[model samples]
Target chain A: DVKVTQSSRYLVKRTGEKVFLECVQDMDHENMFWYRQDPGLGLRLIYFSYDVKMKEKGDIPEGYSVSREKKERFSLILESASTNQTSMYLCASSTPGETQYFGPGTRLLVL
Target chain B: AQRVTQPEKLLSVFKGAPVELKCNYSYSGSPELFWYVQYSRQRLQLLLRHISRESIKGFTADLNKGETSFHLKKPFAQEEDSAMYYCALSGLGGATNKLIFGTGTLLAVQP
Candidate 1:
């Protein structure tokens, strides 16, 4: 079984703070993604990495960035957290042309 | 551009009753559709994919290219089957394997 683990299940940050959400996958997948799940809006992609040090912006990449220094780990970074940035963040990893395995989401609340 | 739409926000049914969750997509190219399920307090996982044409946990979905829909169905709803269902689409060759997800439908199975 594939395992994807997130760094935090819940996090609260003050406005203008920097926040980091980490994800790790055990299956050695080549693609990693970061998304924010919001009510009624679905899961919107924030950023994705196809290989180490290679990143692409998704539909909703503004205010967020990602890092993939290694194959097994992907990290999402918020340059300056704002209240509107609060949402359930999910990390997923997959091999090309395959099903993606998701990590337990991190619910980030910006106050 | 690819987009997935799951119209229903919530659906309720008796334990023994049939259930259907509708999903539609807008993509210019041939689409690869998928159904994902997330049980309470659990991470999201792939329930089924269109290419495989197989059912998981008694759930099946058929891709209708003309209608641009992929609706999930089950003959009988089990209490354990209650979960959040999300429909997703991947572009040709998986296009870097990025998936666009719809707003999920929360299914409640009543006993």
Candidate 2:
């Protein structure tokens, strides 16, 4: 079975701190994504990487950045965490234009 | 721009009653639609896709190009079927096929 794993299931961080959320996919998929899910806002794409060292900004990319050093690993970085950034972060991996396999999700709370 | 919408935030039904979860999409190009379900404390997983044309666990969905909708329906609601359902869309063209998700509907199956 394909597995997309996130580094943390739950995290708490202070405002103004830099935070890192890691995601690793064992399926050898070529695409990885980061999204923040809010109560009524749905899931907003923050960043996506199609290949190693390649990244693209999604609709809501402010205050967030991403790095894909390896095809199996993708990382989401919060340059400066803020209280408003508290939300559930999900990582997903997929082959180009195919069904995505999602991680368990990381619930991050920025205080 | 591609977007998915699930207007109902919550849907409740008796165990033996039929259930329907509405989903709509806005996209100019041909898009692949999908229904994903997340059981309590479980990771979000694919339930059905328009392309498959196969029903899973008694749930079925048909793509309505005229209405731009892909509503999920089940003949009978089961207590185990209670879950968070998300509607997602992916563009078919050369554009990167990142799945855009809906706000989600929480289904409550009353036993």
Candidate 3:
């Protein structure tokens, strides 16, 4: 079975603070993605990296950025945390257009 | 624009009842659809895909291009089947192969 792990399961940050959410997949998938899951909005893609150092903005990339320095790890960075940024963050990894495996999400709370 | 829509926000059913979760998509080209499930305290995982035409955990979804629907169904609902279900669409025109997800439906199977 594939294992996708997130650095944190729960996080709390003050408004205006910079926050980082990390994800690592052991399956060596080529594509990694970051998304925020909100009630009634579902999962909106923030950023996705197809390969190391390559990234693309998704539907809701505003206020969020991502980094992929290695094959197994993808990181999401929030330049400034806002109350509206409080949502469940999910990380997923896939091989090209194949099935995606997801990490146990991180629930972020900005106060 | 590529999009996935899950009409129901919550569906409550009794054990041994039939289950159906509706999902529709809007995409120009051929769409690859999938059903994802997230159980309590568990990572999101793939339940089934339209192309494979296989059922997992007694759930099956058939892609109807005419209606642009891929609704998940099961003959009998088990308590363990309760979870959040998300419909995702891939197979876009570009090589990036990103997925668009629906808002998700929460299934509650009461004993």
Candidate 4:
């Protein structure tokens, strides 16, 4: 089965700390995406990478950054964690226009 | 900008009841619509796509070009069918193939 694995299922961090959320896919898909999901606001894309070493900003890229140094790995970075950044973070991988396979989300809480 | 709208925040139904989760989109070009489901404590996964025209787990979706809607329907809801459903749309002319999602609907199947 195709699998998208997230580094953590739940995480807690302090304010002003740098947090890293890692995702790895076994499908070898070229497109990877990071999104934050909140109640009522839905899922908003933070960053997406179509290929290794290439990245693009999404609708809400304010306090988040992403790294895709390898095709199977994509990492979401919170430069400086804040309370408002506490939400469910999901990572997905896809092949071009096909359906995306998502990881078990990481629920982050900043204190 | 392309957008997706899922008007209902929650839809409650009993076993053997018909289910419909509404989804609408705004796009100038031909759009590809998808329905994603996240069961409790599980990864978000694709339930159906308009292009495939295949039903998974007894759920189906039809894309209406005139109405700009892609509503999910299941003739009989099961107790295990409770999940959060998200509607997503992808437009053709984008290089990154980004998806715009709507605020999800929580389907509660009561036994």
Candidate 5:
């Protein structure tokens, strides 16, 4: 079975703090994605990486960055956490032209 | 431009009733469609995809190119079926296989 795991289920960060959300997938997939899910807005892509050290900005990459140093892990970074950045963050992995498997998600709260 | 739209924000229904979650897309070329579900306190997962042409957990979605729609349908609804449903689109002529997702619909199955 495919398994995607996130570092945290819930997190609290103060404004202006730097936060990192990590995702790891057991399957050896080539594609990894980071998305922020908000109520009524669904899942908005922030970044995606098809291979190690390669990244592409998604629809909403204004407040976030991503890293894929290893094939099995992807990380989303918030340089400066803001109240508006608080949302459920999701990670997914997939092969080329195939379906994506998602992580458990990180519910972040910025105060 | 590639985009996915889910008109309904929430759909509340009693158990045993039929369910249909609408999804539409705007893309110049052929697109791949999928339905993803996230149950309460659980990780998001793929429910079904248009290319698969298979039913999952009693849910199925048919892609209609004429209307640019891929709506999810179930003959009978159950309380366990209540969750957040997201419609996603891909195959935007990119090798990365990045997906564009809809805002999502909350299915509330009340007994």
Candidate 6:
């Protein structure tokens, strides 16, 4: 089975503090994605990486960034955590033309 | 720009009732669509893909190009079927495989 693991299930951060959310996929998929899931807005893409050292901006990439130094690992970074950034963060990995496998998700609260 | 839209925020149905979750899309090219389900306390996972043409857990989705919609349907809803459903579209080319997702619908199957 494809397994995607997130670094944390819940996190609390102070305003202006930097936050890092990590995701690792054991399936060795080529594409990794970061998405923020809000109640009414659903899941909005933050950033995505098709390969190591390469990244692309998604619909809502303003306050977030992503890094993929290794094929199996992808990290989402918040330059400065804000109250508005508090939401559920989901990570996904998939092969080309295949279904994405998602992590359990991390709920972050910025105070 | 490519976009996916799920009109309903929530849908409630009693057990054994038929259920349908609507999904529409706006894309210029031929699109690949998918339905993903997230059960309570479980990771988001692929419920079905249009290309696969398979039913999962009594749920099936049919992609209608004329209407630009992919609606998930089930003949008999179960209490276990209560979950959040998302519709997604793949990027233009198969190489990137980036997905554009809808706002999502929360289905409540009451027993």
Q: What is the TM-score of each candidate against the true structure?
A: 0.97, 0.97, 0.97, 0.96, 0.96, 0.97
Q: What's model 6's TM-score?
A: 0.97
**What tens-digit string does per-residue lDDT give for candidate 5 at B41-99?**
88889899888899999998998999999999999999999999999999844678888
Q: Which pairs of residues clash in candidate 4, taking residues 3 or more apart in a chain or in different chains?
A: none
True contacts kept of 2: 0.62
Evaluated on chain B only, candidate 1 has a TM-score of: 0.96
- Model 1 has an lDDT value of 0.93
C-alpha lDDT values of all predictions? 0.93, 0.92, 0.92, 0.93, 0.93, 0.93
RMSD of 1: 1.0
Q: For candidate 3, lDDT tens digit of each residue in A1-111?
A: 889999999999999999999999999899999989999998999999999999999989989988899999999999999999999999999888788889999999999
DockQ of each: 0.78, 0.68, 0.71, 0.70, 0.75, 0.75
lDDT of 6 by residue, A34-104 (tens): 99999989888899999999999988999888889999999999999999999999999988778889999
Deviation (Å) of B18 in candidate 1: 0.8
lDDT-wise, the better of 3 and 4 is 4
Candidate 1 lDDT, tens digit per residue, B51-96? 9999899999999998999999999999999999999998867648
Q: What shift in Å separates residue A103 of candidate 3 from its native position after superposition?
A: 0.4
Fnat per model, in the order shown: 0.83, 0.62, 0.77, 0.68, 0.83, 0.74
| Best-to-worst ranking by DockQ | 1, 5, 6, 3, 4, 2
DockQ of 1: 0.78
Cα error of candidate 1 at position A66, Å: 1.1
Report the lDDT tens digits of candidate 3 across residue range B3-93: 8999999999999999999999999888889899999988889999887889798899988988999999999999999899999998844
Model 6: residues with Cα > 4 Å off, grouped in runs: none
lDDT of 2 by residue, B1-111 (tens): 678989999999999999999999999888999899988899889998899899999999999999999999999999999999999998874446788899999999999
